[model samples]
Target: MDTETLSDHLVELAYGPKELYVDNTYRRILDSRYTEIVGFDFFCALDDAIETALIDWWLSDDAFWGEVKAFEHWQDEVEDGMAWELMDVWETWYGADGHVKIRKASEREKVSYDKAMKKLLCEHEKKKVSIEAEAVRIGL
Candidate 1:
């Protein structure tokens, strides 16, 4: 395979999403967390920091495999400890929309370090911060 195709395959295996229109906030969190955990540098698309994070994780050192394993362990603990409470949080905060709920719930599940979440990011301190930023930039 060509270099570009090989690169695509590697990225898909490590961080392919079923859809692209995910909440950008969740993308930022996932991308940033993987960068802090994976311990390596990889080429991310220009300004596509989230894609960069995924590529970095996919191409990182052997420690990255261990990091993924740790995430799995964390996910299990979260589900086992607070299944219903989390589900209710989803229903209330997200809404009844199926797609929104699924993506939000996925975000909640994949979140291991809530301390480093988008909620506390240097730039995106609040969801409304991002929402308003988008609104103003795009004049929505």
Candidate 2:
């Protein structure tokens, strides 16, 4: 799927804001390597808009896809030694899930992954603070 094809499909798609978010992600995925939705054969054949739409319908009611932005955040703490990786992933995450309810990836699996990553990030942040406090108290 090229940019022109994605734009055309977006224009024709009958998606609400939420669905549009999913569609937007799907568009990027189409532009990526895994053009097909794995199980489907013709749903990713470059010009098969209908096929793409069909796959979209199949994934219309995902609960996990809604957690992308809510769970992922940009932690821009210069002291944390993050020059770019954190920023880069976060920026990409925002661009993909920002203006659209764009759907891509499997909701079943991705929701869990996103949730776990968020949880771990929070825990790591808390640990960092606790370690700093300990160091300060010990005059180290």
Candidate 3:
């Protein structure tokens, strides 16, 4: 497989849902005689090598950990007080028709609502950026 495809597959095997099962499958594939017969030890080694590199990267990347911390902080903020209420309102509006009274809120109420929504959105975006950065740092 091409390097990008191999890397993508390794990332999925390492980080995807049901990771333990995927890992076991990866190991089994590596140990298969068919792999040896086809001279694919190098390909198998790529996965092992990438896993080691990812571990090393994770251990050495302080910036990645900082991003993780920032993400967690925003995540906590998003779950608290006004931010939490704004998120709930957004979810309610998104998933269903918002209540008529809420939809018809007064201008002053709308301003407060808008401000809270904006704050929540900003925090959410910040959290997402950090998460994507972490993913990139891991070559995922």
TM-score of each: 0.23, 0.25, 0.36
lDDT of candidate 3 at residue 6, scale 0 to 100:
48
Alpha carbon deviation, residue 40, candidate 2 (Å): 82
Model 2: per-residue lDDT, tens digit, 84-134?
544444444343665666436566656765775576577668756865664
How does candidate 3 score on lDDT? 0.58
Give candidate 2 regions above 4 Å deviation: 1-105
Q: Can you rank all candidates by TM-score, best first?
A: 3, 2, 1
Candidate 1 lDDT over 1-140, as tens digits, reads: 24796577665654533233332323333453463322112222322565565556544545655554555465466445454544554455444675544335456554633433433344333433644554444322
What are the runs in model 3 whose C-alpha is more than 4 Å off? Answer: 1-40, 81-83, 86-140
Instruction: Summing lDDT over every window of 10 consecutive residues in candidate 2, give the lowest-scoring window.
Output: 67-76
lDDT of each: 0.46, 0.47, 0.58
Across 1-140, the per-residue lDDT of candidate 3 in tens digits comes to 24696467556657633444444543544453554222245445665666677656653477765665666565566446546666586654443444534344667766766776787778777766776675576444
Cα distance off (Å), candidate 2, residue 134: 0.9
Better candidate number, 2 or 3, judged by lDDT: 3
After the best TM-score superposition of candidate 1, give how far the Cα of residue 64 lies from its true spot, in angstroms: 1.2
Maximum-TM-score candidate: 3
